[model samples]
Target: MAGKETKKGRKTGLDEAAIRGLAEEAVFARGRAYRDEGAVSDVVRRGDTVTARVEGSETYRVTVRIDAGEVDDYACTCPYEWGGACKHVVATLLTLIEAPEEAQERPSLAVVIGSLDRDALARLLLRRAEIDPGLAGWIEAECAAAPGSDADPAPVAAQARAVLAGRYAERDYWDDYRPAGDPAELRDLVDKAVPRLEAGDGRGALGILEAVAEVFVEDWIETSGGYDDETLYPLFQDLGRMMAEAALMSDLDEDERASLADTMTDWDAALAEYGVEDSFALAVRALEIGWDPPALQAILNGEGGKDSGTWPPKGEADWTEGELTAVRLRVLDAAGRHDAYLHLARAAQAHAAAALMLVRLGRIEEAVAYARKAFGHPDDALALARALAEAGRAEESLAVAEAGLSFEPNESVSLRGAHSVVPLARWLREAATESGRADLALTAARAAFAGSLARADFEAARAVAGKTWTSVRRDLLKTLRAAERAPERTEILLDEGLVDEAVKDVGGAPGYAVPEAVLLRLMEAAQSSHSDWVIRVARSRADAIMDAGAAGDYAQAAEWLRRAALAHESAGLIDEWSATIEALIERHRRKYKLRPLLEALRF
Candidate 1:
C-alpha cells in the first residue's frame, strides 16, 4: 500500500501509508500521540537513501533514513524518545506525499546533455576539440555513438587544422586531409571554438582549451587553473568581466588594443548598470599589460569620476605613495629584487598582505626583522616562524612559534609552537648525554613528555617519539645510572628485550618470569592474529618442557592457553578456545606425569 499513488499531482515512491504505519507503531510504543497539526518539513534523497524530516508546530527536526523498500534507521533531534521514533518521520512522510517527482533520479551530466540536438552536438564537439585537442578523439567517439546521430564532421575538421598548423605529427595522414583552407582561418576558428568552454558548454570548452594548451606552453595550462574554469559557467557573466580585466595587462599596441579597451569600458559601464561594484584589480593586471597602475588607481579610488577635469592625471599622486611603494617592494622581491625587497620589507609593517608577500618572496631575514617589532600582529609572527621552520632554523622557529602562542593560547600559532617543543626537548637531551650529564638527560626526557602533553595531545608525543626514538632511548638509559626503581621504565626495558637488566632490576611481579608460551600467546593476541605456525610452535615447546617434568613450565603453558581462551572469547571464537584448552591440558598431563583433571569440554 505504501508503494501506491493516491493523487495525480502527488509524486511517486513507496506508500505514505506504510511509512506512517511504521512511524505510528514506533510512536505508540513510546507513549506519544501524533497531533493533527504535525507537518512534513523536507525530503532529501542521496543515492538510494532518502531522508525525510518531519516537524511539529514547535519546529522540531526529526530525520528518517529509508533505503530501497525498507526503513533502515530513524533519528529525531527532539526529546521524544527514551530511545524511540519522534514526529520527524511523520513530517518527512507528509512531505513525500506532496512532491513525488522530487524523489526521481538525481540531476547528472547525462540528463543535462541528453537534451541537446544534432546541430548542438556538432557545435559542442567542434568547440571542445579546438580548445583541447586531447579531447578531440573522445568527443568524436561520444558524438558518433550519441544515440542515433550521423555526420562525423569533427574529425575531418580536426585533421585539417593539424595539417594547416604545421603540427601534422602523423605525416602520412596529411595527404588524406589536405586543407583547402588558410592557416590563419583555421587558427581563428580554433580560437573562437575555445571560448565556448568559457560559456556554459563545458565539454566543448574543455576540448577547445585542451587543444590550445597542447599547442602552447605550460604557462597556459597552469595559469588556466587546469581547465577547472568550466565549472564556473553559472558565473559566466562575471567570468567575462574578470577575463576583460585580465586583458588590460596585455602588451598589445595602442591601435590594435583600442577596440578591446573600449569594449572593457562598455563592460564596466554595464556592470554599474547592474549596480555591481568592480573592485577586482588583480584580474585587470593579469589580463592587460603595460597598463599605468597610477592612472588605473586614480579612476578606481574615485579621484577621476565621469566629470573629472583630468582623465586619469599624468603626474600627481595616482595611488598613495605608501601603498604603491609597498606593492612594488613586494613585486620586486618576487622578481628577485633581494636588496630592494629587504629595504621595502621593513616599511611594510602595518600591511599584512605585503608582509605575507615578502615572506613568500624569500626575504626571510627581513620578514623576521618585522616579526620582532610587530609582535602585536599574530599573522606577522606566524609568517616569520613558518619562514624560519622552512629554512631549517629550528631554534629560531621554536622561539617565534612560542611568542605567537603566548599571544593567544588557542590560536593555530599555539599548535605550531607546541609542535616545536618535541624537537627542542630531543636536542637538549642529546646535548646532556654527549657531555655525560645522565641526570640532565633523564630530566630532559621527563620534561619533554610533560611539555608534549601540555602543548598538544598524545599523538604529538607519539610523533616526537617517532622523530627521536633512538635519542629518547639513549636518554632513558641514562636514568638507570641514578639507581631509581621505575616499573614504568622497566616495562620499556623488558619490551626492548633488555632481559638481563629486567631480571636484576624488576623482580616483583609474576609478570616478569612469564614463560615463552605465555609471551607468544600475548604477542599473537597483541597483533590481533591466531597463527597456526605460532600456535603449533608454542604447543611443541610446551610438550617438550612437559616431558621434562617441569611443573612450572606446564603451569605457564596452561596459563598461556587460558589467555588464548580470553582472546578467543572476545573474538566470539569460543569453539577454537575449547580445542586450545584440550591440547593445553594434555601437555600439562605429560609434564606432571598424571591424567588431566578435566575429561571433556564444550564451547
Candidate 2:
C-alpha cells in the first residue's frame, strides 16, 4: 500500500499498519468501528491534505496532511490529550484509505467567502453572530469602529469598563475567576483597543487596557482574595500583546510612547500593592520601548530590590526572581545569545533548560546526559522521557518513565499517573512488538493498564488491555481480585461483565464494610439475578446508616430502605417488601425527626 496513488493523484501515505502504529490499539479499533459505522463524513481532499468530520459523542473536525509516502501532520478538534493522534483523526484517515470515492468536493473557504458580496457576507456574519454572541462581540469589536474615527476614546473606555464591571458585579469570594469570560466580552474589549493602537492612538489603547487590567486585578482580589497564576498569566499575556502592538505604531511620538510606558508601570505598581512581582506587561513594555537591561531587570526584581521583605513574594504570586531569570534566559535565547543562556541555566542547575539548549545546539550526547540528570528530579521525568523518545532512545525513554512511575504516591489508584506513564508504556509495547517480543509487549501493556488503574483511568486501562484481554483475562481478574481497594476491583469486575464474581466480592451477609456508594452499586448490579441478595444487602446497609442516630443518618437509611423495597417488589415479593418497610418504620419510629419521612413511605 506504500505510495499507492488514488484517483485524485495524491499518494495514500497511510496504510492499516501505519495508522495502527500512529494510534493506540483501542483508539484504532474505535476509529475502525467509527469508519465502518459511517461516522466519518463530509470528507474533502485537496492536494495532499484530507479534511473530514468524525461523529462521536461530539462531532470533531479531523485534518490529515500526508506528504509523499509519509503522514506529515494529523490534527483533530476533539480534546483528546492522550499525546497522539485522536480517534477522530484515525477515523478520518481510515475513511480516506478505504473509501476514496466518498471524498466530497468542497469549495475552499476562500472561494466561498470571495463569491459572497459585501451585503451577503454581512448577512451571513449576522446570522452566525445571532447563533454565537461571542462571535458577534468579536466582529463588533473588530469592525464597528474605523481606525482613526473622530469618536472620543472616553466612550470606548467606558464601554470596555462597563463590560468588565458587569462581568464582575455579581461575583463573590468563593467564585473562581476564570480567564474565559462571559461570551468573550473581555477579549472584545481588548480587540476594540487594537484598532486604536493600529491608528497610532497608543495612549488611548493603553488607557483601555489599563482600565480593564484594574478591574481584572480588583475583581480577582475580591473574589479569590488572592492572586492566581491561571487567571493572571493569561491576562498579562493579553496585556503584553497589546503593549507590543501599540509600541509598533510609527505615528506615535515619543510623548505617546512614554505615556504608554507610564500606563504599564502604573499597572506594575498596582500589582505590587498585592505583593505580586511577576508583571509580564511591564517587562514586555520596557523591552519594547527600549528600556536599558538594568531598568528592565529592576522591574522583574521587584521595585524595592532583592533585599526587600517582599522580594520573593509568596502564595499565588506568579512573579519571582527565579521566574524573572527564566524570562531573561528566554530573551537571551531569542536574541541568539545561546552561550549565555546555557551558562546561566547550567549555573542555576536548571538542567531542563540546559538540556533544551544543548539539544538546540545539536549537542545530542550532552543534552541526553543533562536530561538524564534532570530526571533525578521527579518533576523532570516527563520531559526527560519525551527528550529521550524524540532522540530515538525508546528503551531509555521507557526506563526513565518506569523509574518515575514508582515515585507517585500509592495512596490511591487513578488516571493521574496514566497521563505521564501510559505514553511511555505504549512506546515500549510498540517497540517490543516490533522486535518479536510479544511477551515483553504484553508486559508493557499490562504495566500501562496498571498505571491507568492507579490513576482511576479505567477507560485508558481498558484500552491498553483490549488487545491481550482474551489471553490474560484470568490473570488480570486474579490480580484485581487481590487488589487493596475492593470497590475498585469490584468495579473492574462489573465493567468486564464478570457479574458472578462481582456479586461474590461485594454481595455477602450483613455488615459489608465497603463505602455506602459502592455497596449500593453492588446491590444494583445484583438486582436482576440476585434480587434476594440485593434485598438483604440493602437492609443491612439501611440498618448501618440508621444506627448513626442523626437526622441526616435517618434520611439516608430511608433511601436504602426504599431501594430494598423496590428490589423486593421487582422480584414479586410483595409480602417481603411490606414486611421490610414495616420493620424500617418500627426501627426508626422513636426518631421523631425521621417519623415524617417514614410516614410518607407507607405503602
Candidate 3:
C-alpha cells in the first residue's frame, strides 16, 4: 500500500490505505476509475501539497494538503457535501500516487511573487486586474492605504458594497457561473481585510465585514425571492470567522469586543429583524466563536421570539421541530457533547448519526440495529452490510445490501447514487464466493453488469463481473442483444472486442437509423478482416443517407462513400473502389445539390 517513489526519491504523499481511509470504498473506486480514465490533469506538487484539475460534469480544481504522510486537508471546487473526500480529490490523490512523475514541482505563488521586483509585480497585478475588475478593486484599495498614505477602510467598504449591490442588477436565472455577479468578489474583499486586522486595525476591518454582511442579509432576507443562498451562506460563514479573528486583535476595546460577541450570539434578534425562520450559518458561527451556551441553546430549542412581521408570518410547514432538532444535534456534535448529540439523533430519527456514534463507541450490536432500522437509506445499509461482512455474517450482510439497492426508484437513481451500489455489489460478490456459491455470484455479477450497462458504464459492469465474466459473457451478450436500444447492444459488443458481431448486429438491421458514429465504427471494425463487407455496408449506408435528400444527409453520404473507397483500396481492389464511387455518383446524380459534394470524394 506504499506510494510509489518519484525520480527525486520523494514519496507521493498517498497510498492505497491512505486513500481508502480518506473516502468510502465506493468513492475510492470512483477516484481510481477517474485516474484510470485520464480525468486528472495539470497535477503539480509543492512540498506536501498536490494540486490537479479533474474533469467530471465540469472541470473541477482539486488540492490535497498532506502532512506526515496523511491527508491533512483536501478540497475541490465541485460542490459535494457528503462529509468525505469527493471523487475529484480522490482522483487527484490517485494520480499523485500512481504516477508521481506526472505531477511537476511547482513554486508556491507567494514565493514566485516574492521573487519579483515591485515594478514587475505591479505590472503583473495590472495585467491580471484588467481581466478581473474585482482584483483591480482589491489592488486599488490596498494601494490607497500603502506605506505613507493615510489608511482608510471606509472607501474599501464602500467599493465592496457597490460590487455586491451590482449583483442585483446583473442577476440571470439561466447562467450558473455568474448567477449573482460572482460572489468570489465578496470573498476577495474579506481576504483583503484580514491583513488590516492583523496590523491592529480590528475596528476598521470589522467595519468592512459588517458592510458586506448587511448587503448579504438585505439581499437574502429582505427580498421576495432572494439571490442565490448557496453563494451567500459561505460568505456569511467567512464573515463570522473574520469577525472572530478581528475580535482577538489587541487594539479592540472591551466594549467593541462585547458588541461583536453580541452580534455573533444574537441569532433570535437577527432572525426577527430579518423576518426569516433560520440562519443556520449564523447559528454555526455562534458555536464556532464560543457564544454564550445558554443563549445558543435557547435559539436551538426554538425559544427565540416570534417573527418581526417584516415579511408574512410562517405557514404550517415552514420549519418543523424535527428539523430544529437535527440542527441542535449538529451543534451538540460540534460542541463535543456526544451524549446530547446521540440523544437528539435518536429523537430526531437521525439514524445515520446514531449509527456512527454507536460504532465509534464500540457498541457494534446497537450500531447494526440502527443501521437496519435505517436500511431504506443506501448509506446506512452500506454501513450495516460492511459491518456484518467484516464480522463474518456474510448472509445477513448480502440480504441487507440487496434490500438497500431497492431504496431508490430504479429509473430515477442519479450517477452519484449509483456509486453507493458499487460496495454492495462487491460485498455480494465476496459473500457468494466465500460460501462456495459460484452460481449465486454469477447471478449477482450478471445483474450488476446489466444495471451498469443500463447506466452506460461498461467499466463498472466489467469490474462487477470480474472472473465470473467468462461464465456469464454469452448470457450478458444475449441480454444486451434483446434490449430495445440497438445502439446499447452495439456499444457493448464493440467494447468487448466483438468487432464482427457488432458490425453484423448493426449492419443486418435494415432501417434502424443507426447513429453515424456507430456506422463509422462498424466500417472501421470490418475494414481489416472483411474489407468487401465494409465496402458493401458503407455503400448501403451512404445510399440510405443520400435517399433522405437533406443537405446534411448528402454530406454524410459523401463521407461514408469516401470510407468505402478507402476500404476497397486497402483490400487491393482498385476496381471495386472506383466502381462504388461511380455508382454513388450515378445514384445521387439527379440531386444536383449533391453533385459538388460527390465530386469531392476521391477514389
Predictions: Cα RMSD each = 25.5, 13.3, 13.0
Model 2, 1-603: lDDT tens per residue?
554456666557668878877876546756776888899999997666689998988778888878876789887766476767777888888887777778865656777899999999989988997887556544444443446554344554455555554444543435644322343556665566666764566555655666556665565566545544353556666666565544433345667667756766776666677766546453444434442345343443334444322212333233323444455555556557687666556544556677767766768677766665644443345566567667777766656655654444322111112234555565566656655656666776676666554324344334445576666666666666667664466667676777788777764766355545556666676677788877787777677757777554565667677777667777888886777567767877898877776776666
Sort the candidates on TM-score, descending order.
2, 3, 1
lDDT rank, highest first? 3, 2, 1
Provide the lDDT at 448 for model 3: 60
Greater-lDDT candidate between 1 and 3: 3
- Whole-model lDDT, candidate 2? 0.61
lDDT of 1 at 124: 87
- The lDDT per prediction is 0.43, 0.61, 0.63
TM-score of 1: 0.27
Candidate 3 colliding pairs: none
- The TM-score obtained by model 2 is 0.48
lDDT for predicted candidate 3 compared with the true structure: 0.63
Q: After superposition, how far is residue 57 of candidate 3 from its true place, in Å?
A: 25
Worst 10 residues of 3 by lDDT: 309-318
